[model samples]
Target: MANGRAGELVLRERRSLGGADWLYARLRQLFKNSIVILALAAVWEVAPRTGLVNVTFFPPLSEVAAAWWQLLLSGDLGDHAAASLSRSLGGFLLAIAVSIPLGLAIGWWKPVSEYLNPFLELMRNTAALAILPIFILLLGLGETSKVAIVFYACSFPLLLNTISGVKNVDPLLIKSARSMGLSSVGLFRKVILPASIPTIFVGIRQAGASSILVLVAAEMVGATSGLGYLIQYSQFSFLITEMYAGILTISVIGLIVNYVLVTLEQRLTAWKPSARE
Candidate 1:
């Protein structure tokens, strides 16, 4: 009996070790994947120092980092970064608030959808940047104009995704819901909206990207502070290092935001992926 118990303990220890080994293996894969970026950075550092590339127009990454440091030390970085983030996220959320119910209503009511489709198609296709002048005229080029552009930029994706999700709900599910005597609202809440989450999130991601792009454009137009404004001012003053630094900030911000959204998506939709697996 002692020998059997020892054998069982050994097996349990081996299983625990195996699980840890699996986790370490996955971490190693992630590290290996990052090597490409390290190689690129090394090449970037070397190419400029060697004078193989024109460093004046295309500043080295180090200069950009130094410029960023300068900006941070000057205490202006926080305000600008905050402004950009506020505008981007603010628009994204506003878009979500307005679009979801409207999209659902349109999708649920065939006549409403038909009537609105033409206008939505036109509005979605319209250039968000082009409306800058109009917004300036109406909202006076302050925070409101910039935020409005962001809102407009983000709105289409949310609306489209919500509508598609509602419309594409399975007919079989609807039939079953009807047979079970579920009310219309119950069918929608239980069957359609839940099913649409994945597609809706795709639109949300796309709109997020669009929101950032429009924010940059709006900032370029007339903003005292923001990442886009930094880029514009740097370019105007021929401060290539500062310009690239601004671009770097934008890139890092986008990556971080996308990562957060992706993480949230994965967590919220955990059941879908888990079920599929």
Candidate 2:
């Protein structure tokens, strides 16, 4: 009984030590990852104050943070962020809904792909921004146009990646599943879909980034409320600090969205071996 109790104590101690080690390692990794961002921030803060850069044009990071805080307090940031996020999410979701199934169909059906290849090639080669005027003319300078442009910008990446994922699935896996007497639908559900998920997520991340970038540009045109509009208005009014604040907000939002998607991807692909491992 005494030996068992001693063993239990030892195990508990080891577990505590393991937990501590893991926490320390995580903190160290975080610091290493953050070093470059910290260095850039330090430079931004010091350059203007030390006259390494013109203070008028490039205000210190501290000033920008202050402006950002003021905007937050005034509720302007919330309102603009809401508008931008809504537009981005609307377009992004629409693209996902349309692209994924279509890509799967195109990849699976040779005839369908052959029929659409010419048109797909032509449209994919055309830049989203290059056709912005057409969207504006057709949809008008309203939320519809902005959302349409973002949707257009985000669609190609998602569609192409989905097609690639489906086409590139391992033939051996499909053969093995079929040999096991799996039906076509079962084979797709069990093997193809799982195998294609990582690639689909890659497209999702790209489309997410494109959605933000394109929406910001679209908002700059005729938007009365959005981060892009805020930046533009601030710049025109010579509110440089506020402009920087808006830009900073957009950057933060991008980082957050990317981090969220990465986390989701990691969770979904937990069975896959990571390079870090």
Candidate 3:
């Protein structure tokens, strides 16, 4: 009887576990992994307070927070944040506009793909910063130039991802849809677009990141009113605390952008399963 009861309990537990969906599973997985970050923060806070490490380069958490508070109250932080966001989003939006239709055409049409893919591969491989001088010469050291640099940096990933996503769309699915009276337009709209979304999103996420990186570099090179500028200014003045605060701002913005993109991807691609889940 004891052995039979144990088997019954195991079966019940498996069934219960199987009932949870991907969201619940992922939350559980992350819960198990977050201990390390909490421990690191503990160390950061503890070491400076205890004088185990020099506080000059690594300002105490309290000092950093104080600097951040002062910046926030003065509205300077908000202004810098807005400037960076404008540059990144403006460029990112332009990339999406240019890359999506071009990607579709290149992916679906063999002649176009063969003719254009080689050049695209070269551009994608080239470093964005390497051509900064050319951009500055063509557009000057103005907002237009900064935005253009970001667009150049971000467009490659979006184009490549769009092409891959469209090409890898299942022919069998398209055939079945056609058999069921889906016209070329209908089939593409319903099946192709939905099917390619997961892969296409990967490119979009990368493009978003590239936008941030390129914008920071642009600001570092010339701009005087962004988070990157704040860091540079603080460094020149030897205001180490303010410099660290600017760095923390950059980190926070990157984290927020990544989280938003991840959330959007999850919401849009409900049919897929994540590895973590």
Identify the candidate with maximal lDDT.
2
Model 1 lDDT per residue over 81-148, tens place:
88999988898899988998898899899999899999999998899998889998999878898889
**TM agreement with the true structure for every prediction:** 0.89, 0.92, 0.85
Candidate 1's error at 119, in angstroms?
0.7
Candidate 2: where is the Cα deviation over 4 Å? 1-17
> Can you give the lDDT of residue 178 in candidate 1?
93
Q: Give the least accurate 10-residue stretch of model 2, judged by summed lDDT.
A: 1-10
If the candidates were sorted by their TM-score against the true structure, best first, what order would they fall in?
2, 1, 3
RMSD of each: 6.4, 5.7, 7.3
Badly placed stretches (over 4 Å) of model 1 are: 1-20, 274-276
Residue-level lDDT of model 2, residues 180-277, one tens digit each, is 99998898889888898899999999999999998888888778999999999999999999999999999999999999998788667766765744
lDDT of 2: 0.90
CA displacement after TM-score superposition, residue 276 of candidate 3 (Å): 9.7
User: Ranking by lDDT, best first?
Assistant: 2, 3, 1
